[model samples]
Target: MEISGYIALAVMGITLGLVGAGGSILTIPILVYLLQVPITLATSYSLVVVGSTAFIGLLRYRDHILFRKAILFLIPSALGVFAARRFIVPTLSNILGHLLLGQVLVILLIIFMGIAGYFMIKRPILDIQNHSHKKQNIKKSKVVLIGLALGIIMGLLGAGGGFLIIPTLVLLMHFAMREAVATSLFIIAINSFIGFVTNQSQFIASDWGNLKKYLTPSLLGMLIGLYIVKFINGEILKKSFGYFIWVVGIAILTKEFIL
Candidate 1:
């Protein structure tokens, strides 16, 4: 079962490589449940592993870079990430009320997975023919607000908030799914790095026992997944991944809350 769990992480890597968001969503579960890593340390480890993997994804999708738009999101997100990891995560206690913090985090993850699942499954509602004007209507002010919110979620949950950003990219920025996903990789990398640096001191001190056992396979899997994505048509894969997300979400809820 332990070995199977480790093997299953290849899917996590590929998902992150493809989406720039789901890797950490799956990482925490594998580390904490399968490998028996503690929840708090698993959160920190997820940042390192997912950030590293997604950085490589960003490079693969570099041509998709849209600095003019990417920067509009990255700056405010960076600040939010730094503050959350530096201040909030450190101060958090082991328990909130009667429940373990880990329990709370898992529940939150399940909620997000459900929402993200919907995002993946839905067809694009906005049209691209007049997208230039739609893009213009997306105010920088609103982007900054959303970016900050996303950053805080990443810092607190150790999951990339791509589901939130990708829609903005497609509907408001008028990017296709692939471009939005690639741009999201850039955002995740920027946000993850800020959070990682804020916790650098403790990160250096923590006993990240056999973390490489997880990272090596994840990176390898991401590379494979990236290649596979090129051959797939867009909407087909989108709805497919959406259903996959629902399965994962339901599985997590059953394991954490019910089982």
Candidate 2:
């Protein structure tokens, strides 16, 4: 089981390397179930793993990162993620019964998985000629709002909000797909890092070595995945992965609410 867990963590990194966003979706589940971590700690642990891998990925695209946009997007998300991890999660855990909140969060994660899967399957229509218009049409307010929301979700779940962030950058900020992806990776890395570092548990000195144990192999997998992407078709892998996410989401729902 432990070896299998390591393999799963690597697979999570490969997915991230292949697709960029879905790995966070798998992080918490991997930590909670495969690594046998508690839900509360698992979420925090996930941030470390996801953030580290993302930062590594970001290093490759360092030249492509939009500093202006990344910083603007980070302001709200950073604060929100910190606040959620510091104050909100513990409160929620206290207020809701263990079965209730875990069940509810699992349900929400499933819904997000389905939405992510759908978008992965349905590639958006792109107009190469309208690139300039797409770049100029973004609403700063929408960007800020979404940034705040994404931060909170990331903090609470310890999952990168890449699925949502990528679309927001493309649709709202008028960024090209490549730019949007690079920028989103930057945003996610900063957001997760801030949330992980400022966590309340740090004051109490929680066991972060556990996170490193899971993170090390995932990073190795990410590097291998990066190499594999040289030959693989990302679009095809993305869609197939989406279907896999859909199935996993349904399976989680079924396990929680059904049999």
Candidate 3:
């Protein structure tokens, strides 16, 4: 089971490296189900794995990143993540029954997975070629709202929320797909690490040795993905991964309710 979890982590890293999103989405479930980690502990583990792997990937795409846009989106997002991890998560954990909290978190994760799968599979049609027009239409307010929303989702789920970030960059910030993907990694790495660092209870509880074992293969796989991404069409890869996400989500749902 532990071996399987490690392999899954590698795949998650590869996915994140390939498209700059969707990788962290796999982290919590892999920890909880495959490694049999407790849900709350799994979330902390997820932040470490996802944040580290994403930072590595970001380095590979550093030249493509737009720092200004990354910062603009990051400020509110980081605040949101910190607040959620520090206050919201503990409050809810205490208020809810153990079984109920687990159920609620699982249900929310699955719902978010479904939403991410939908966005990946259904590529939005935009007049992205008209760069100036799109830039003119950019709404700074919406960007902040989206960033805050993404951060809340990340803090709660321990997922990087990259699925939403890429779209926001592309559609609102007028970033080309490559640039959006690169920038997404930057935001994810920063926000995830911030959330993890601020949540001292969870961070202190995490097992560094165990995390290192899980992280090794993931980092290697990320390197492989970075090499292959140059040859593959991202759109095609994203759609295929989206279908895979739906399948995994359905399987998880079945296990949770039926099995």
The sequence of per-residue lDDT tens digits that candidate 2 reaches over residues 139-249 is 687788888988988898888888888877767766777777778788888888888877734534346556668888899888887778778888888888889888888
lDDT of 3 by residue, 45-96 (tens): 7888888899999998899999987787989899889988998888898999
Best by TM-score: 3
Q: List the residue pairs that clash in candidate 2.
A: 134-174
- Ten consecutive residues with minimal summed lDDT in candidate 1? 124-133
Clashing pairs in 3: none
Who is ahead in lDDT, 2 or 3? 3
lDDT of each: 0.74, 0.78, 0.84
Tell me the deviation in Å of residue 169 in model 1: 2.3
Candidate 1 matches the true fold with a TM-score of: 0.86
TM value for model 3: 0.93
Model 1, CA-based lDDT: 0.74
Q: Give me the displacement of residue 240 in model 1, in angstroms.
A: 2.7
Residue 159 alpha-carbon offset, candidate 1, angstroms? 1.0
Q: Which ten residues in a row have the lowest lDDT in candidate 3?
A: 123-132
Q: After superposition, how far is residue 245 of candidate 3 from its true place, in Å?
A: 0.5
Using lDDT as the measure, what is the rank order of every candidate, best first?
3, 2, 1
lDDT of 1 by residue, 65-84 (tens): 78787887888888888877
